[model samples]
Target chain A: MLSDMQNNEFQTYGYTFKEVGLTPGEIARFLKVDPSEKEHPANVFIHEILNKLPDNKEITGGYRILPVDDLNVKEGRLACNNVELNPGRQVSTCLQKSEYIALFVCTAGDIFTGLTRRFNRRGDSLEAYITDAIGSLTVEKAMDGIQSQLEKAMKKRDLQITDRYSPGYCNWPVSEQKELFALLGETPVPVSLTGTCLMIPIKSISGVIGIGKEVRKSKYACAVCGDENCIYIKIIKK
Target chain B: MEDLLNKLHNCVEFGKTDINSPYPPDRKGQKGALEYTQELLEKGASPTNIMELALIPAMNKVGRKFSENKVFVPQMLLSAKAMNVSVHLLKPYFRTGELKRKGVFIIGTVFGDLHDIGKNLVAMMVEGAGWEVVDLGVDVKPEKFTEALRQHPGAVVGLSALLTTTMVNMKPVVDAIKAESPATKIIVGGAPLSSGYAFSIGADGYGKNPQENVLWLNAIGYAK
Candidate 1:
């Protein structure tokens, strides 16, 4: 039994490059160019790509807090109301003390994917690459919005929320995305899973956040994750 | 003619695709690789010379900058795009055997890995470097690679896998290709791959990025 959650009821965010907190310096870093140079050609290229994005485009994400019926921290599993989840170590470790959990889905939407494909077909792969990066940043910003909303809701209940944990992260296999999507009830962001379990819109993300008074967020979760290629970790190091 | 060729090289190096392209603001409204290549050809510059002098040198500079970490995929892709436009104008010469391609290179992402950004980058870079690239698209199987090898004999192969889980799948592809053609060089790359892991999986080389792969191909005499 799944309950439909209205997309309008949850906090959703739309972003431009500036609103997403993406700086030229960060874009330069991602491009592996010298950020010290205030007027690099890459910076100009970044601006050009930004200007080409649709003004009406929005990357929306929202979450619903669901009651957890049971949780087993040692076994790294949880039964959240109607959905039984084996969230794995990384998620369960952060979720053990939670009374409830929030299931969230965020998407940069199909517009960006369509734009990327168009650029690719036109042989403007540079624009395609930049658009793809922008999509990533948009989804990340949407996730940030979802986290803040979850935090606010938890605060009203005298509880705190743990860091966001997606199924593909750490020991939680990507195959579990089906269960996560199922738990979220109706699609909040129009993201679908492929036959192989990969997310469509390519830039969409889904995750779970534990809500409890004792759930503490890690200061630097990227450090513990061991994925050296993570953009967040790279940004922190720089 | 030399001045026009030099301008064409600069256009490609800086990723100026055309007069309408707004990138590299300093060159705004200036004729880019497309116009410059056409103008150079009109001035009676040899197609082979345009490739060897203008396109090849520009791509080499881009590849070096990429290896030095001075440019990322966006920058590299721009440069590759510029080079591609110039190459397109010279395609007639290639078809006539007047402008020879270095060799055939087949590339694809391994099965279960739907990611194509990295694969596309590599394919474009290699194509810009004067190779004839046969892109097999994404989620390719080992048999497909072997079949491609059968079709394009003596061609080099590239496999990409963005996920750690799918990276392990490269071993089977590598083994299958090697079994079919022992002389064929196989390279692997993606976010989760390292040169050490590439070697462990029987891959001949591992490129940290597309530029590195171009460099490796050059080093192995894949380019003339």
Candidate 2:
């Protein structure tokens, strides 16, 4: 189901609704509809919004792996292929034994953003909210796709990998996004940072995955943060 | 005339904008809030009666449902839009002091936060509640909020931040506003904020969502 989504492309972005793995419950949560009210107008409206969405398009991602040279765990600093990084405590602990790090950027593209703006302009906030939620889910699926590709490439070399860690996650400051973008050279996804370090398209994400034998993959890390409204927390609870 | 007022109320409640709007499928081809409001005014309905009897009551229901989580942002926004259609028709009366707004509401996204969806939602909801809203837009500094308070005395203030990092900026803005006008009622909200955090930063109240903000404003005597 996931690989088939990668085959679907629109303009510069490859996407598929199937890859997004969106469920009625998830959509309902984003729409703030009661979970039991399956026939609510908001639910119907969400369905219409989903149907209006471009089927063959969702998200795109780009990534590159670089060897890590010098590492100072005490100072929580890392040097990977001449790119100095202060990944902070959380990322440092995750990447301590990594021989290489996969740097990646993923974006849900401009279609959803444009549609959201259009809906907002037309006074159809329901459509805008539903579309924006879908866009967020798309970016996550794109990141998952990138991780899977990286795992596939590493399998041939008999290398295991760690869980992905992103800037603004754990102790890594969001400012690190600039360095990640710089290291990627020419990003496959058209993700750009705003003056305040927010990614453009608003649904883009950047992260690094450590590659090595001793690196452990964390299945759920919602415990690291205490945000009750986090989607990850909701998913984990489910 | 009473029937027309009820029609206008139901139109706003159901987010029916006009006869052509297809939303709330049941009301698809009916004359919506837009048409009913215009017709009522044309047929000698006072702006004050229309607003007090229909628009405000419909928005109040919308606000209450929103606070109870029975209605979400989109539904509330649609209702706000429906109410705005009638409010637009009443603007002339407001200019002549014939129709008084509930109160002024000054809102903005705190500095370093470019996110405005939450702020915009609050602005629309407050405006729907019959208050005059002055949106300072995104990335507003402490001075900007204080300056706005100076211009619109006794106006309530709201600060929003989507990021945890940026949410910290609300402290300084709240402090600045309090320093300038101690009587001002300040409310804060965003994804990363809790009531505890808001209280810690000297905010008078914290709304978990837009509807709660309106309720808080009402509780604090900002109601019409």
Candidate 3:
């Protein structure tokens, strides 16, 4: 229903939703919306997923890598687990190093539905609601997307994807967004970054697939990278 | 007097919500869009005159500033806030059927993606341009969009994704919408989205930002 502009915020943005449910207060604060407003149903599920997020695990051998389009020998060696991690070992005894590794990452991709209805109601701050919902959904989607891609890419290579890693995770500095971008030639991939390196569209994903002989580079690396607090993590050593 | 509109526009453009609100340290304590809008309204100003001469122009400026990288999210949020304050004052007349929206829009972040900021911005900007936006929230399934389309008939649909991985999910949703409602226009956006990608995914349009989405909607002559 459209109307002449009055002091109506709803009219400014037709339908709107505010962050509602569990962390609605926190999200509302982040989105700069009034938290006391009626809660949106989407926020309920968002909280549910957030609460249930499995601890982030560096799932070794969880995925395989496949060249989505082309695979050239010039790109380096493509060896299965044949390559030995010991640099001093005989080269002939090891699998040839593939110049670059392209693997699909995957994780359990289950969240809830009806988020919009829960957030955007008949009478509410449409803009504020949408903003809050965007923030919540983006992170959830991005993480899942990256995980899923790793899983899929690795399955193709027949070699397991050591737990996916990005530059900023663990010892990896946030500054690696650039190197990672360069490695993937991300500009052509439709993904971009803000001035502060925050990924937009919030639900987008990114990750790294190591091209090494050791199944996981090293078990220690995997342990350090495991997000023990993640809702989906299968194991939590802590 | 000509510069007064620019000043008012800038106040809103930079996100000065009201005369009393303190933000953007540079414009602290000054009359904001809220005051200027009310003042304009009381001065026998036509609604169209206020919109065309002040509000629209201000948003346009903000949009341009945003495109040029002179401003970022915080500044844009402020501008949106200022614009909202003025719009809040204009709501009653519309509810009374004194005004009309150009059309309806249904938007959301695709399944597996829970982000909504970019979608929200588009919703706001489109609404400012006189569209009734039905925000489906995050992780929206295609059926919900189809359901909304069934209800609205010709409403435009916007899909947002912030992750490269979640963008894949958009294809199935778009396919579903196209299968059920061939004529419903769809728009896609987010960090990992581009015009090329939007076309590949079968969306009718792509918006890089809220302001751009407004311009796109207006350019298609969809607004009445």
Candidate 4:
């Protein structure tokens, strides 16, 4: 059903589950939506994709992570507080292949398309627009699924996940996206990293989590990040 | 009536909702899509006709604009909001047989994929195109889709996944559905998915954006 161009774009623009060090079952758990049922659209889609998924070997070494504390945590140093202090634990996983490819799609399509469908129902733009607001409200709940899974995984590892942070979150610059990509061995997966650091095709994600042996209170929003919240109280605008 | 339709179209295209909505600065305080659509229906325009001539066409334009990159996510979302407002006014008609939807379209993010923005957009867009949309919400499993299909036998399905890691899981779900109900059509989308990925997984359709899906469905002779 997919066009040739669309198929090619998908191949280049997105990554497979194995490429990101995850299995279908693992992902299913994180999403909390099973694919075995016929009623779920996501399950149907996933079922189709898995049909052609290549069996890639598990890649052992691609990422090179240097703890923030080891990099530049000495006294009298130009301090950037975003750096993880005490340089918490580190863990990395990747596919068995030498490289991989990926993409980045946006959340915009859901809002627009969702609104159109709802409005058509009422034949009244007013009610549909209100529903649109309600629909957008679900974004938080959606992301919650991911956060909860990560939390569970961390707990199992006897580690505390300190605010699962993506590349562009807080002081983590977009430039750093390249670093993570390199660590993942982008060339093997054949992922194209765009100039602006956005993974093309709009579905890819790269992030880092500070895994600490101890559980500590964390500021939810970047604005109140504790490192500076106590001393300067300069809210890092989210 | 034509002027009102034009304004309504513009409101949806430019993301204007009503006097209170301020996102699209170009048309502030003007009666937006919400009011215009209601007015059109009140002034002897059939909801069906209004949907066809005004809402559908306007949304098609917005969808085309999105595909061509003329508008980004935020602007597209605005237009969607306007379209949604217009749809809400005509919902009851849809329920009582005053209107007939083209077909059923089911959509959701795949299991283990919680992101809903893309899936929701496709659901809305397909629904706008006059299809009876059954949204399964995010993190939907294969069995849920099959179950929903059992409930709505002839419905077309759309799958969405935001993560590359979870995209592969769509395969088994598709297989299960095809095994049980081979006649059901499936559309796969999301950032990580390409047309190749969709077909590789054996979906019946692929849409780059919500508008494309509408056009594709239209070409299948469902446009009204």
C-alpha DockQ of every model: 0.31, 0.29, 0.02, 0.02
Best by DockQ: 1
TM-score of each: 0.79, 0.75, 0.53, 0.52
lDDT of each residue in A67-168, candidate 2, tens digit only = 778667788888876888898866787677887777777888788778877776786666677777777776876777778877876776777888787877
Tens digits of lDDT, candidate 3, A1-238: 1122111111000111221122545554343344453332224333554554344431111223322222223332223223211111211112223223433222221222233334445333443444444434434334444555544544565544444444334433434454444434323223465543444433234454543333343445445446432322312221
Q: What is the DockQ of candidate 1?
A: 0.31
**What's model 2's lDDT at B216?**
89
lDDT of 1 at B22: 80
Q: Per-residue lDDT tens digits of candidate 3, residues B1-224?
A: 34556666778776777877665556668888888878876766656555666766777777777677676444565676677777777776568766555678888888877666577667767766667789888878889888989999888888988756678778988999999989878888887678999999899899887877878777764543
A1-238, model 1: which lDDT tens digit per residue? 1233223244445554445666656666766666775445566667776766665536767777787888887888889656788977667877878877888888887777788788778876766776777677678766886688668866776788888888767667777887888788774467788655677878888888887778898776777776756655654654
True-structure lDDT of candidate 2: 0.79
Off by over 4 Å in 1: A1-61, A64-96, A170-172, A176-189, A223-228, A231-238, B1-7, B18-23, B28-31, B35-46, B222-224
Better of 1 and 3 by DockQ: 1
Between prediction 1 and prediction 4, the one with superior TM-score is 1
Root-mean-square deviation of every model: 4.9, 6.2, 16.6, 18.8
Superior by DockQ: candidate 2 or candidate 4:
2
- The candidates, ranked best first by TM-score, are 1, 2, 3, 4
